[model samples]
Target: SRFAYVRDFELPDRLLPGTFILLRIDGHAFKQFTDAHRFAKPNDPRGLELMDHAAISLMREFPDIILGFGQSDEYSFLFRKSAALYNRRQSKITSILSTFFTASYVMHWKTYFPDTPLRYVPSFDARVVLYPGIREVRDYFSWRQTDTHVNNLYNTAFWALIHQGGQSKKDAHESLRVRFAWPLL
Candidate 1:
């Protein structure tokens, strides 16, 4: 029954009625998004225009999502379901399964964003949680953490994320140079 790993803390309840998706875009893209916002004059309409441009770009590729991007060294998404989505379970994954994913995101974000941390939300605050989905993720994490073998898969996964996830492959790989791989499965 356990299909995925989830953080033990807070998460959204009820899968978003519309398809919910999470994005992990390059850090540079996130920076551009924020920089444009910061440079905008106080209450400038250009700020909104900039946002509109960015949103259009993101949606041209990921059409159907109705929410804004949530960035913290990476991108996350929350949107209502649209019929055109290919991943029907995306809503469930982000609102619920994403708890575990955030542990990874927050950990990575901390390497740089220690000054500002991502807040953990409780499941009670979720808008549309169902009992069965909760049981599924809990079971998955239980089995994963309890596994007798410590393959250090988590560590490897993190390294891979940074190494392969960046725009400059060399720069991204450099991020791992001083760091030793320590898988804490």
Candidate 2:
């Protein structure tokens, strides 16, 4: 019991009160993982569905989470402003949600990909952000959605250049760079 004082070294990590808390989780090194597992280009329906299922499971488990937004290999969960879960502890909330989502993804993998075998375990990284009001929350989600749309468009064009236009990887990148360049001659 003498060593219990070590607990005092832990810093206080409570989130701001009267603020909406968002826990966002993203797949770590998922581009390589997806490539290794041969996920469909631009987007994979199975992977997206699996992420949605995992998010739904988390929402069900933590009723305080009011909304979830997901695309590609990332998801954002928004908690009610009045939620007192874990006393709004940052580390506790993020760690639990990340672990739960990752476990749920692995557990439900077979259901989504019955024919494709899992090559290796997948993991996710998480962060907790606080928004002072509903407007900020809406802006955050809008930013994420816009990011998804822009990324999808770029990836589709990149892949199309490689597969359809017979461009090498480097050439495809160059093509996109030129196309995206400002003040084109």
Candidate 3:
């Protein structure tokens, strides 16, 4: 019962104008990862279980939103936050911490596997060095987070969706300018 599969996936039409634009900062060069190893296989017993855990965690944190979740050696997600309660300032604080934690996790991998081209896992929209043991732990934690779902901090799906429409960093800046300009107008 570690993992279950949903055979079909359908996107609601409203989201066409707004999808969680997904991107991944894969940690392929990290020391602890390699392409040769496996707990079982891709979509095999353990991998599937891990994916299930991650999905549940993301879903629980943003119950009303649709998350485009995927994982390979690394993980990625996207969500819409139009209805979220948190504002830009508080959200910014969490984003900084989230980056720190994610970076720490990736760097720690170097102590495990020394060499491999794990820079990307296009098939799964993932990017990391696949280590069975690490993945098992990661999956377990992901599942645990679901049972103990937090409030705004882990609602990454919502953040991703709000960020998707911008064309570049500059576009993002321009968008914010317009948003703030709205009240004045």
Candidate 4:
């Protein structure tokens, strides 16, 4: 017997062709992973190199990817506004790109870090967001880059206080607050 059709079945959402698409992927529990692997603080040359290699592979694999920006454990891929890949399906686009990047990273891990074996398979999550115009997209990326810089500064200082200055986590945070004249706790 055939089942009855349901009205509330999965709804379909299609990204408009004229809008720019950004697919951002981030490592899952990357902080713990980094700590376990003893990744160099502030910047890990080998880790960055691995991410770059994976990104390059992603670009080469998908011609629709216009540009990519990556720092630390995240990468954002920019697709042309007119791209019709996978019929501009948000779920398909994000899932495929994220999995592909994770695979590439795993495949090239050895090339970057020979001594440290991958303890477990790393995974990533992705989301696709649309921007109505090029200006908005540009501003969006500019904002992201600026935030990255600011966060990097904070993290670098925090780690320095812990490592070099021999301060506890709470003391380091308080020190940063006092040094920067930040009133909020």
Candidate 5:
């Protein structure tokens, strides 16, 4: 029982009460994973479906998660302000959600990619952010949605230039750069 004193060394990570909690989980090094798996460019329906399935599973497991938004290799789960899950422990909430989501993804991978074999395990990293009110939450999700749209548009144009127009990768990038005059990812 003497060793129990070490628990005092653990830092406090309790989230603020009466504030919305958002947990965002993002794929770790998914570019390499996608390349190794030969996921379709621009958009992979199977991959998206797998993510959606995993999110749904997470929601079912944690009913306190009121909303989920996902795009590409990332997902955000919002918990109600009054939720008492884990007593609002930040580490517990983030770790559990990310781990559960990852497990669900792996568990259901075969269903989505029936013909393909998983070469390696995939991982996701998660962080918890608190919003003071509904306005901040709305703005946060709005930003994510806009980011998805912009990135999707860029990817579609870039891939089309290379795959359809037969332009080299460098040429396609240069074309988009010169035409858009905006920084690309």
Candidate 6:
């Protein structure tokens, strides 16, 4: 049958083995989704806790995960480069990671927020990046941590201006722009 030819289009290419693989997954449209669901601002303890639980579940379910690092709505799962899971196919790896993480998040959400039902569907996107050496992996983690720290500071300041300083959203954003313009000493 001519229609059966469509089934053969699946692409399969094994990623090169023998390198550190980092699969990072990030929430899609999380800001608006969080706002619609009324998540607490600055940092949501319940949300963060849910993320941690999901990451732990991933590590337990897949023994190949060496470590899991997460901040906010994103998590990075580290796997030994030698793992042959899914034949090291990029599409398979990324799709599975994203789907699994999203499922975990949804499954754990009710435990954290019992009364609040998920108002809408949630999803995550994932990518696999290879680090050739220990130094690059170290730098990658350092960079992620630094990024989280700066974002936290900026968000904290932004929210403080609204709550404590009694400034409007626009004003708070403007203030942040000016305050963060100078480099840290």
For model 1, the stretches where C-alpha displacement exceeds 4 angstroms are: 1-41, 66-185
For residue 9, model 1's alpha carbon misses the true position, in angstroms, by: 14
TM-score of each: 0.23, 0.90, 0.30, 0.86, 0.93, 0.90
TM-score of 6: 0.90
Q: For residues 39-153, what per-residue lDDT tens digits would candidate 4 score against the true structure?
A: 8987899999999999999999999889899998988889987899888877888888888899999999888889999988788888998889989889878877876776787
lDDT of 2 by residue, 36-89 (tens): 988898898999999999999999999999999998899999999999999989
What is every candidate's alpha-carbon RMSD to the true fold?
18.3, 2.8, 21.3, 3.4, 2.2, 2.3
Answer with 2 or 4, whichever has the higher lDDT.
2
Model 4 spans with C-alpha error above 4 angstroms: 1-11, 178-185
Give the Cα lDDT of each candidate: 0.39, 0.91, 0.37, 0.86, 0.92, 0.86
Off by over 4 Å in 2: 178-185
What lDDT is reached at residue 55 by model 5?
98
lDDT of 6 by residue, 6-51 (tens): 8789766778888888999888889988898788988889999999
Candidate 2 pairs with clashing backbones: none
Candidate 5's residue-wise lDDT over 65-124, tens digit each?
A: 999999999999999989889999888998888999999999999999999999998999
| Candidate 6 displacement at residue 162 in angstroms | 1.3
* Superposition-based RMSD of candidate 5 using all C-alpha atoms, in angstroms: 2.2
> Candidate 1 at residue 134, lDDT?
38
Question: What RMSD does model 3 have?
Answer: 21.3
TM-score: the better of candidates 2 and 3: 2
Better of 1 and 2 by TM-score: 2
